[model samples]
Target: MPYCPPDCSCNLDGTVDCGGVDLKEFPRNLSESILHLSLQNNALEVIPMEELSRLQNLETFNLQNNRLTSKGLPDDAFCSLENLLYLYLANNKLTVAPKYLPKTLVSADVAANYLTKIYPLTFGQKPNLRSIYLHNNKLTDAGLPDHMFNGSDGVGILIMSSNFLKYVPKNLPKELFRLHLKDNKLEKIPKGAFDHLSKLRELYLHNNYITNDGIDNETFWKLSSLEYLDLSSNNLTQIPRGLPRNIVLLHLEKNAIKSIPGSWLTQIKNLEYLLLHNNKIKAKAIHPLAFKGLKKLHTFHLYNNMLERIPSGLPRRVKTLMLLHNQITEISRNDFAYSYFLIELNLSYNKLTSPKIHPEAFRKMRLLESLDFSGNNLNVVPSGLPKNLHVLRLKENEINSIPDGSLSGMTKLKELFLSNNKLKLNSIYPGAWKQLTNLQLLDLSGNQLSYVPTDLPESLEYIYLQNNQISVISENAFESTPNIKGIFLRDNRLTTSRVKEIAFEKLKFLQVLDMGAYSESATESKKDGGTSGDNLENDSEQATQNDK
Candidate 1:
């Protein structure tokens, strides 16, 4: 049996855990055969080199979330652990990386520290070292040498985000597969900075001050294996040239890009996700054939732009297209003629009106499952909505009525939000939602309703009628919605005597009846010879517990 410390737990498999014991110092008398030791989440400030060297067979050491500083760790602190494979020293006060690391180490995490510099040989010649995480540190370009990882030929992943580097580090390992330099002060990328990194697949350079002139034309042309590239939140006025041909996901949102010429994206055949929202892109500035060759593209986001109409030549196989918060006033019939595979469409917060939207605008979208047209100028729901839509949002509009047979084809609708409109009791057609057998949630709050609308779907589970003019709940108000679980009638004019007891007696599954602000309002209505004040208070309390 291995000896276990008084404040730690020891196992037969050479593992010791001493985490979160408020330990002020390192434990003593650890087994020499220990393979893993965890001292995280403690107050340990110093590591006894001689005592730690006794565990020659240790392979993993974790000192994360401790108070270890540079003075507590000597240059040769971990030199004797020849078999150490992983080391974690995150969340410390070290200003510099420790020197003379073991050659057998495979991974090192010194992130979330005060590290401002790293010696050239701090990592030594560890041939097996693969990953180095130094994020959330105070590292600067002057503290880093040109040949940072020259000895570690197998280093594949290096993360140095949130640093003060003014430019891309030079002489990185050619075998690097992923490099993260985001959230830095980088201003430019030299011509041959990444020419040797052919195996690089993911590069994150977002949240920097890089401009269009700061990048060379041939900077990223040689990265043939690159797949994911993020250049968002930059100062580029146009799309960069010479991107990798096989790139998959491209993020250029929150930039100053104004236009995309036809040749900018004609070479990227394997692109899947293209995010260009929050830019200054206009519809006419984009070439007609800008997205013609992207056959595998699925998601395209162009919201928060200056587009006045749908861009032509969208990806044929694109499934999600987000064009909200634009200046588009009309939707022509041929706008989406080739985008038949779209599953989700969001054109909300635009200048669209009822007559400007062609009646056959959405006729080709048979596979669309979600549609949002809220925050527009439409006075009524847009017709020609696909039958397979599962969610529909038309709130914050001027809609006042639901014409008969308008929504009779949406039998698969599950959630319908028509709140914040001008709807009234007599404006809605009777049995408008009778064909919606799969409906589950209906939102009609912030309207001009005088009474509960009859002919609600039987499959409804939740209803929102708050902030309306509702004053009565007839006995048959909820007769068709026996499966209802929650009814929100707060901020309405409902009184105790007007809300029949039988209206809530049949709702056995009702769990929430929000009638807040009703007591104060009902008291005023009762003073006008409505009902007895004592009876109104008693019935209101009983309605809240009907489910019990």
Candidate 2:
């Protein structure tokens, strides 16, 4: 009789959780002040007696996914669990291993189950087991369990993912700090599964099929406090030399890693974040001492990666440079002349036609701000931006108009991601952004606007004029402009509208007024209605969302 689910609740320490409920057995009379008990997923298949050691204040008994297999449970069950730590008998059909658990256990997540074998005193009855989730089950690698991380803080997070690991277990346990041997059947990585992690840190060896000859240099001279290194997917083609310079973040996307290893960017040099997308590197495999000592690199993701070019001794103190798609057609300005602390430049999709932007191509950027040349084949819009460039992502390309002053030398231009190009309808060109007076986010959604051009820009906040071809708003259409906080004119088509005198009253900081995804009209030309959605719903944003 184990059916206690009146929406389950019991605080003061006892944690009873009938997780996922679809029960098939063991749900009999709980409430002995449960101290952590989640019958995850449910449909119990036994191990029910000891009635949870007669509620001696239980302490974590999550029969993960239910339907048990092996028994030998009630030797006084958890014998009045003396603060039982955490025992989660993983997914069902257990082939054996469930012997008298509870030895002041610290953590045990018998991953997936179906015990193919595990009898080395099965955790010697939990000698304070410190984090162990036998990933996916069917353990191999020569039937691990010689003393699989003999506890005492030794097993500090070990999830043998997917299992049947081909290697990676040269007796690992120098107090491992977190090691999920991802999707196994490994091709290698043994040689001292990190010879006693020198205080390892976040290492999710992704979908392994392994390569890079299973890595060298004594497998990273003992992870020197590794910081988050997910060797993405895998079958790595190269670049796995001696990597462990206090890695800050290195997710070698997809892998078949063709390049990028000037000795691992000079031994990781506190690398800031380098996600090598796709990969099959070329362009002279970038070698000017490729990122010689990544002086705190700040985000450099090589998008799509087939690279026609863009990699050249890179390290102009990068600050976000994601080269989209690739096969870059060409756009030399000394390729960021001296990068001078480059700033946000994502050359979208690529194969560009003639993106000639050399008016000294940003003269040695003086902290050049956001600049993304959407998709490519840009027909126009390029006037040496960097006069304090703000944000300018020329979406999709083949730009039709809006290039007269071509953004009058961006005097601190705000945000302007010109939505999908070939802009039609009024073709927006009121002096090509009437010298953006500190304009604000203005993504013209997916262009082709029909009407409503009242010259918006008083430090506008956000105005993505939804899809195209409007109906009306032109009572002078935002006559005395400048005060907009947000006004995305929803999905255009419009009907009921007015807005005559003092249109939007100098927008005293109008906050977010998305006209119904685009004129479903019905703010009735809002006069007393829209001060633009309560100007930032105050109260300090409800005390910063209650301190999160």
Best by lDDT: 1
Local distance difference test values of all predictions, in order? 0.87, 0.69
RMSD of each: 3.9, 15.8
lDDT of 2 by residue, 92-209 (tens): 7777565445667788788888767665545554557778788888877566566644544456787888877787865566777788988887887766668667887888888888
User: Using alpha carbons, what is the TM-score of model 2?
Assistant: 0.36
Off by over 4 Å in 1: 519-548
Candidate 1, residue 216: how far the Cα is off, in Å: 1.9
Which residue pairs collide in model 1, if any?
A: none
The superposed Cα distance between candidate 2 and the true structure at residue 144, in angstroms, equals 15
Candidate 2's C-alpha runs over 4 A off are 1-62, 65-120, 123-146, 149-157, 160-170, 173-178, 181-241, 244-312, 315-358, 362-382, 385-403, 407-415, 418-548
What total of clashing residue pairs does each candidate reach?
0, 12
lDDT of 1: 0.87
TM-score quality measure for candidate 1 = 0.94
Model 2: how far residue 290 lies from native, Å: 4.3
Measured on C-alpha atoms, candidate 2 has an lDDT of: 0.69
Please give the distance, in angstroms, between residue 396's alpha carbon in candidate 1 and its true position after superposition: 0.3
